[model samples]
Target: MKRLIGAGLAVVLVPVLLLSMLVAVLFGSEDEAQAAPPGGQPGVVCTTAPASGSGGSAGSTTGQDVAGFSGDQLDNAAVIVGQGKALGVPERGWVVAVATAMQESTLRTLNYGDTMANGQMSSSRGLFQQLDAWGPLADRLDPAKSAAMFYTGGQAGQPGLLDIPGWEQLPVTVAAQRVQQSETPDAYAKWEQPANQVVGAVEGRTCTTTPAAGAAGGTSISLPSNPRAETVINRALSQLGVTYSWGGGDANGPTLGIHDGGVADAHGDYAKVGFDCSGLALYAYAGIGVAVPHQTQAIWAAFPHLTDRTTLQPGDLLLYSSNGAANGIHHVGIYLGDDRMVEAPQSGDVVKISSGIWGGNRGAEFIGAVRPGA
Candidate 1:
């Protein structure tokens, strides 16, 4: 009896020790891990901006009156101009509007749900998200007008502007909060540096007050720099009539969304393996110098502007509605021009290029156009 009891205690005690060890491993402190560099690699600044370009002289800036921002803030005014111009806003007004948008939205046209209550999110939309219900509003839903109005008329003395003190004289962030009445007033300030850099690169300007390049002479609606953009478009076109897969947008992906890295299988045709919406863009731009993100929201956030479908160009990204009944981006494709696009299609299909079709219907929601290399 004594021997049997001792053996039973050993079995229970051994498992208890192992279980404690497992718990220790599983619940180990994460602070040390966070302190370590990502992927166990050190010396990487995860948030560094891309290198600037040698893209020539940015002209003078003439826009709404802004006084409080530091002179250095104007460095990226050109990128803001190029970005705003893409959105169809005038250059002078573009600077002011961009400053405001950088203040309000950080130049990103987000689709995520906002904290603002009421229908401001529903009726008012895009980068500015201005509401039509607001008195004397210009197509408030339009990013251009909304940005302009927000910039030009944002005043602290105004009733709604009271939330932001000294808004008119404050930096873009303060002014934007006054106009937007956002719960978080300081959010827009984070974009100041990046917004300025992008604007300066695209517009070729040193400051918001500089004379802008002949507005019409700058930025033609032309092809971006992805050298392989044309090649991939051609390759995808060669695979027309392939069936669609759920996650099957790349060459190496299985069916759809089946492959790792979200790349579709190459389907073993031209050895043209692994290309999803981002993959296609990546390969295309790799031919040039730029690299795009893989995910849809990241791609949208990285791009310059939301362009109209009528002005679609080769290598432009085409997004389709996903939210059952013509809303929310569920799929994406590459525009090959001439109303033709290259896409993975849907489930039961291999990676192939064909006339665009979204959910068995030709009238897929045209989310917007993106110029891959500007």
Candidate 2:
């Protein structure tokens, strides 16, 4: 059993989950994104934003579990939290939303919902058990849409989380109760801890504000002292100016990208031939026979990650995460000494050297450096 800390109180959490419900559909999706490179390199050609649509990532740690959250469950959690972020829901709102989902549907996107009084089956469905009054059935089924509805509410009479006055000051259960109106209003409290864990894991480190001063500009590469490192840098640098395709690039070379169902899709990344953040890193390292998986987190764990960013050398992969933890890693780049790095940033951008480790990419926290073949 674990203990969950809340507003001046703590609640014991039973590690085991008791399922009294049926399984339902799960949801999530992703790739990676970025900004510019060194001097006068036809960098990020387009800055205009794409048409708004659904967006999701397969959560950072998709293949693993966290706090007993399986890949699917975690993926759904990611969607819920991601949708919250897109709608400007604060972190507190994210916790409340996830906790409510845990109590209502155990984080699964349910096809069936609760039955209310008078013997008629309530039309509640989806992750938060939204009802027929919440809008169309399709919106309730999509994790992203459902999450958006949960945070923003639907229909004329219904109100979402933010619509509840003082929701920020309320406890997880209280806030959730205002939105869900569950029979067991207090049930949301027990999930507070796990919900926090889920949100933190999915949201990761985000820095909207500028980072502290560090090496930032100039496209010139200062080749690493190590031959292996030099080789990797050369190969990565060769790909400079390449378009950034979500899920594109591999150990062999650039490949087709997968759909992200949102901004990336609008940018037509799925049809482009190029590399994403980690894909570029893995492909570059392949030149030196250093085979790492295409995923950022995998590459982070595949080699010795430097604890001190100041010790970075050329060809070392700089890892960034949504959260500061390893499990939150989502992007990677080739470190080209003097604070410069090459990366395939995001939709509508090209492979280029950034001014610093945190250059071009917003909301991505610079975690550390991964030296492949070190």
Candidate 3:
């Protein structure tokens, strides 16, 4: 009788246990799903010595070694870099000045711009293409004086890097944008790569920011141990300071203008933009052969759930949602290790790195992470 009772109890409990497990699988708790991803050895190992002798000492008059540039162009580039040093700007500042000059005037010290519709001069000139408001006409035309004005504001109170608080922490393009206030703010970003090369050649040493030779399109600093992860992170980093426009980027690249008028218009960002949050992730992952949807919710659904956040690798994504619902997912950022993340924040912002991904209300509720192509 005792043995028969025990057998009956076991038989009853087994089916209940099985059913409970099925329910758990079908409707797991948010805590269970949100468990942090595992952490371990870095997926990619990057080993490259840092470059030497960034910007030279002030007033050193050191000769530069610029290759593939005409004598006049090289001379002007040196003047720009030298003036940056004289103004106490760092090597990164030198790169920004040179790159800005390259885009504005090709270091040619232009004396004028196309006549306006009103038949008046555009009043833009010099390596930086300063307007007459930048300084007296003669000062705008003088290379050394103009470069100085570029780094340190001229008599007209035009803001320079020194004038902008925390300019050093901003990306090269952003720092330049703060000073130039160009109509096309993103144009300066294109010159960063070439500018790095020019600075490296001039300094007779590799620039710390120089991307590795043959790096996918020569746009990345170093490749990681995981080739795909390397491509994703590098491609994303290459877009630092790119404008955040709603529906502005796709797998291919940045689109011409803002395509979505709903949320983007609400944010007052209707101009041509670079990338939004999900769009940046989409493009970055696509570079590594991973297809991520442009919408945040779809991107979250596409990747396999990482059970442990600590295990998140470099290219993994940290997604955010307001209510933990499928449609609630609204933001995404790529993890860069050491608690850093790269993101194309909301309107009026640019692609940049932030210290923590979960500090703000938008990221308050942990929605777990996903590793694409892992």
Candidate 4:
């Protein structure tokens, strides 16, 4: 019999776009989830991994045949799901975790760091983008090893994350920081609730935060006033066919468009309207007051841990590999179910919705979707 991993979850709202453009957009140079390694005090290390194979899992039931996600995304999802099951994390948590990853490093373990210099890039190390400056490599490339480090800090003092303040009711960012010690703790707080909501819907499960037994109480991370509003998405849609620019969106930076898609002239700051990969992501979410980081790598750093891609939903990000590196996913977009996505296409292409995989373009590729406000 197929085991019901974590908790059975429900499906979330999925989007449907007509033309989708997913090229190298919003690509950032940084390592996300930089945390202290394990070997500290021992906590509740749930030895049993959660059971991922559901009897009849819902949502994107098409399995590997789904046209949206690429082979890499599917493979990554399978691995992540297996990992979540091994850890016995609720299915909802697993899905939300993947969404968090989507918002972060696009699920590609990083081998470099942010900040390019003198026409040279730094060769940092590890999964979830760890910097070598922190220390030498100690099982850095291994996702499990990195995950262990992340959990060591993220799950410190709390069994099943019960000790973290507002974790259960917060966004993926908040819940993530509870486990992952980050420079910007507040940043992760915002993604907590959305991540949970997305995970719950994808896994067909329900998570609660009423407190277990004698657990202390904390304030829930309040969600945006209207999560379902199409203001941001709509604005992004309106600004299709924009050119790409690098370093367009940083935290509290200019407001033209910093991500990949959309159309804009090149100039200093917000003089014109252009965006790179991360720029577009920030612009779209900013329409709704989300205030996402300008750097794509920072997005990964400031959120909960993510798992597989089968748990993706609309408004979620779909990051894919531009170059065929083992785990090098360089492109990103907003997921619109049925293998469709809404994003700013590459040069010569307008902002439009298209197939997640084949948006009628030779270079168009589909990776995995990241649920930001899941």
Measured by TM-score, the strongest candidate is 3
Residue 321 C-alpha lDDT in model 2:
82
CA error at residue 155 for candidate 1, angstroms? 82
Q: Per-residue lDDT of 1-374 in model 2, one digit per residue for the tens? A: 01111121233452121111111111110111122221231111111232122122337647555456656777898898788888998767777788777766777777875544576666878788888888888998888998898899887468899898656644455567768766544456457666765665565522111111112221222223344554565456545555578998876556667899998899999876668888888888787797878888888888876867556555667788887898988778776555556788888877766654555553258888776676
List, residue by residue over 31-83, the lDDT tens digit for candidate 4: 11111111211011121322133212334222332223323433444444456
Supply candidate 4's per-residue lDDT for 27.
17
Question: How much lDDT does candidate 1 score?
Answer: 0.38
Clashes of 1: 40
RMSD for all candidates, in order, please. Answer: 26.6, 20.7, 19.0, 21.0
Candidate 4's C-alpha lDDT?
A: 0.40
Most accurate candidate by lDDT? 2
lDDT of 1 by residue, 1-374 (tens): 00001111111100000000000000112111000011110001112332233234433333221122222233234444544455554333343355455443334343332433454334444345444444333334344444444544332233333233333233334344546655444344334434444354444433222111111111111113332443444333322333333333333211223543333344432222223454444444544456666566566667775556555555567766555333365556766544545565543343344443333565546566566665
Q: Which stretches in model 4 have alpha-carbon errors above 4 Å? A: 1-68, 116-124, 132-138, 154-166, 177-374
lDDT of 3 by residue, 227-311 (tens): 5655676677666556677877777555434646576777755554468888889888887688888888888888777647666
Over 4 Å off in model 3, which ranges?
1-67, 115-121, 200-206, 210-228, 238-276, 286-295, 298-314, 335-374
Error of 4 at 54 (Å): 11
